[model samples]
Target: MERPTRAWVLHPDIRGDDRRRAPEPALEEATALAAALPGLAILGSEVVRLPRPHPGLLFGTGKIEELGAVFAAEEVELVLIDGPVTPVQQRNLEREWKLKILDRTGLILEIFSDRARTREGVLQVEMAALSYQRTRLVRAWTHLERQRGGLGFVGGPGETQIEADRRAIDEQLVRLRRQLAKVEKTRALHRAARAKVPFPIVALVGYTNAGKSTLFNRLTGAEVMAKDMLFATLDPTMRRVDLPTSDEVILSDTVGFVSDLPTELVAAFRATLEEVTAADLILHVRDVSHPETEGQAAEVRTILASLGVGPETPQIEVWNKIDRLDAEARAIWQARAARAEPHVAMLSAVSGDGLDAFLTQLSQALRGPESDETIHLAYPEGRALAWLHNEGVVRAERTGETGWDVDVRWTARQKARFDAL
Candidate 1:
């Protein structure tokens, strides 16, 4: 039998400043989840930019009743709100609308929970989930918590289930921390290995669905998943990219940032975000076609600052998705590119347009000068020679009978190490 599409998305805006106007962007995120998951169909979505809230419902009682009628007529099985709702509000809303309800936090958590493929990722998601669930324990299970325990309240210590839940959550948190620590240790070792062959790490970061993963794959020829959805790529992915100047570097694709990211998620995903903290360069990919492009860029910068990425960190703003822009806007951005600050690259990652200019600029930034140096090495200095081979742009290598003659053009760090040797 065929079932009706029965999911409705809601975005609530608590009116304040211009920033609190419309939450269509958040509703769009919820719509992406509906697209990914099965059995739930999104019937429609609405934004309620209200001046005040109601106690029983987030909206006024009259509006709530109005939405209730709409839900009934539309046969909505689920109501996905694009904002965090309290446990009591969720309970009341579900009863009033006669449907399941999920908030922005819950939705984001579910996305993370689904996208977590690795053990560490799964553990982190579970830990975050448990932390969130501990507060909303009422939603999952409706039970009396005031039963007398023999040990503490009414039942014996062994029979106290609430204590067991608390204990279990603590134990899980400990285990997750230990596992994440191990993962961090392993990542540190890997980072050290990369340092030995030091390639500048460039990370692409932007708002969700900002085409970061697409740009990443376009640059590195990698097949990492790229979709037009919120939080498409959860884990960090790194790949080697050979620039236009024949300089090879490591380009990392990081998880996209969003406005009003759940605080729990920010802490939970710190492990994955360490890659961004270690980046030598950041490509702030902006969806220039998005109506909220400037606002999205502000959010990305805000998150970057909160992550302690200092002002001195070199960044190249890549205004992506120019293909989606109209001709006038594209031309205007192009004209303004000449005066664009320190580093701004306007290009369409999908079309491979203007990529050469961006790559040329990046290569020049990576390799400051092309002053070739004729370097001499003592006999049997294979280790130093190998280091040069890996880290430097070796123009020519000649193995003489007495020693080795190498003409290398590399970065300052590589030259310093070679000079030390």
Candidate 2:
């Protein structure tokens, strides 16, 4: 087997910046990102304090030289920066250190490229990658000085290598957009079919590695790729799940959200995330044990709001991974959750603790407001009676001389389905 490439992660702690996060947790998250990619063995990680960023080098010259020595001593093959790195800064850093360098966006693109399974997901990643690469064309093409003499048919002379590469990338993006359109149409058709099935869709969303897939597997009893790694599941998966109240729902597991998610990726994956927009209920699964859980939840909410998921959409906060917390912390959180808002549920998806309560809550959320209705059906309409019985919606039934009078408590969707039957 090929040995894993040696890598180092660095998180720049920008002093005096109001938006700067705590350096330690930021560095830890960056290291986790690097570890998520295959074929990369992290050698070390650190938080570099920067009073101010240098425009060209991103770091002080002394710091660069110092880190260069460390990189050399450690035999690091790749260096990942936890924040944005301009193309010029990346080029200069790579040249000075003589090693491969990837900024946060690039590292995330690599992870998405590796994890995407479905055709639409792969295409979206390719488009985003191309878009990202288009900006770095200057650093990529060493032959930018070379000019091509174009014929009259090409309509331009003195087109540099960079321009040619940009044009090629643009063309590739167009092609990808067309292919994505086709896939989106097919997905829309599938969604339309599901709409006819009379089952509400419940989407699970959270920050990366927040145990959404684990919760999904626990609820649906289907094996999905659940792991401790970031971006463990990129493609959306759906399964029919019967909730504790005997109401069936379509449960959807989506790609996890992250802070500072690349704009190119967000636009590219809009179709995949549209499932969330159409959902009847959303479960915001969170790793309650993480120190930055609140910050992570804020990021997820920001992304959702940007996707047009607003106050009108029903949502439940699923406080997951409580098993990882200490006994005192867990009890404290549980108490807080109990006294908190109505839609919050504290549970560990791994050990099945509090799953029953969660499912019951989920059933209630998806069921919406229920009302009792009395209907009289003739003796020949056995199918309608069987449908109501199978749905567990019948409150009471009385037989008469020619027909039956039934009292049922159901949501509008259930009533509609029964009427159609």
Candidate 3:
């Protein structure tokens, strides 16, 4: 087997910045990110203090020399900076340290490139990566001085290698955009078909490694890729689930949210996240066992709001991973969740505990006003009858000489679908 690449993670702690996160937790999260990428062995990690960023080298001369010696001693193959690194700074750092360097955006792009599975996902990542690379062409291509030969009659001077490379990237981006548009249209059609169904969509959204996929698998019985890693499940997955109230719902597992998520990723995944926006209900899953649970929750909420999820949208807070907590903490959280009924649910998705309560709350939140209605359908309308039965909306039925009388207890959407049929 090929050995893993030796890597070191460094989280820059900007001094006197009140808004800056705690250095320890930030460093821990960065380390987690590094571990998520396959074939990377974390040699070590640290929080590099920076009172102010240097224009050329980001770190002071003394610190540069110190880290260089450490890198040499450790035989590090790559260095991952946990924050933004300008092109010039990245070039200088690599030159001084004699190792490949990846900034926060570049690292995320790499992870996304590795994780994306669907055609749309692959296209989006490629487009985003190209867009990011376009900004660093100067440092990326060493053959910028090369120029193409041209005929004197047609052109005096041909384009340089850098210009040609940028043009090629831009052209590829355009093609990718066109292809993405086609895929999006296909997805829209699929969504439209799903919209015609009576089932309401419930989306699971949370921070990375918060067990959204675990809960999804527990509820839907689908083997989606769920792991204890950041961005483990990048492509969205959806399945139909039967609730306690006998109401069927479409549950969607979405990409996790993170603190300071790269802007390019946000824009690139907009189509995938539209599932959340179109959902009839949103389940904001939280890993309550994490030390930075509140901070992560805040970040998820901020991203949701940025996506235009208004206060009017129904949402349920799912406090997941309670199995990881101690008895005392679990009891306290359970009590709190009980008091916050209909809005919060404390559950361990892996252990299948408290899931019934969550389903009950989900049923309550999704169910609209109960409407009892009787309808007469001819013998030829078996499709509608089967739909009502499949949706678990039929309460009673009576057969007559000419037709069948069906009584259904359903929500307004179900009633409307029946009416349409």
TM-score of each: 0.84, 0.92, 0.87
Best by TM-score: 2
Residue 312: error of model 2 in Å? Answer: 1.7
- Candidate 3 local lDDT, residue 327: 92
List where candidate 1 sits over 4 angstroms from the true fold. 1-5, 17-21, 36-39, 137-164, 368-410, 416-421
Model 3, span 1-421: residue lDDT tens? 9999899999989887666888898899999988988999999999999998888899999999999999999999899999878766776897899988888787777888889999999998888787777666644455333221100001112237567777887999899999999999999999999988878999999999899999999999999999999989999999999888888899999988988888878988999999999999999999999999999999999999999999888999999999999999998888898898779999899999888978888898897678888989899998999998988889999999987899989888777777877
Query: What would you estimate as the lDDT of candidate 2?
Result: 0.88
Each model's lDDT: 0.77, 0.88, 0.86
RMSD of 2: 4.5
Residue lDDT tens for model 1, 96-215: 887778777777777777787777688778878777765554332334342221011222222256557667767888988898889878888988898777578888899988899998
Lowest lDDT block of 10, candidate 3: 147-156
Residue-pair clashes, model 2: 0
Candidate 3 colliding pairs? none
Q: Candidate 1: lDDT over CA atoms?
A: 0.77
lDDT of 2 by residue, 1-421 (tens): 9999899999999998777997898899999999999999999999999999998899999999999999999999889999988766776898899988788988899899999999999999998888877766644455333211100011222337568867887999999999999999999999999988988999999999999999999888899999999999899999999876778889999999998898989988999999999999999999999999999999999999999999999999999999899999998998989887568998999999988888888888777899999999999998899988988889999999989999999888888888777
lDDT of 3 at 405: 100
How many clashes show up per model?
8, 0, 0
Model 2 per-residue lDDT at 372:
95
RMSD of each: 5.6, 4.5, 5.6
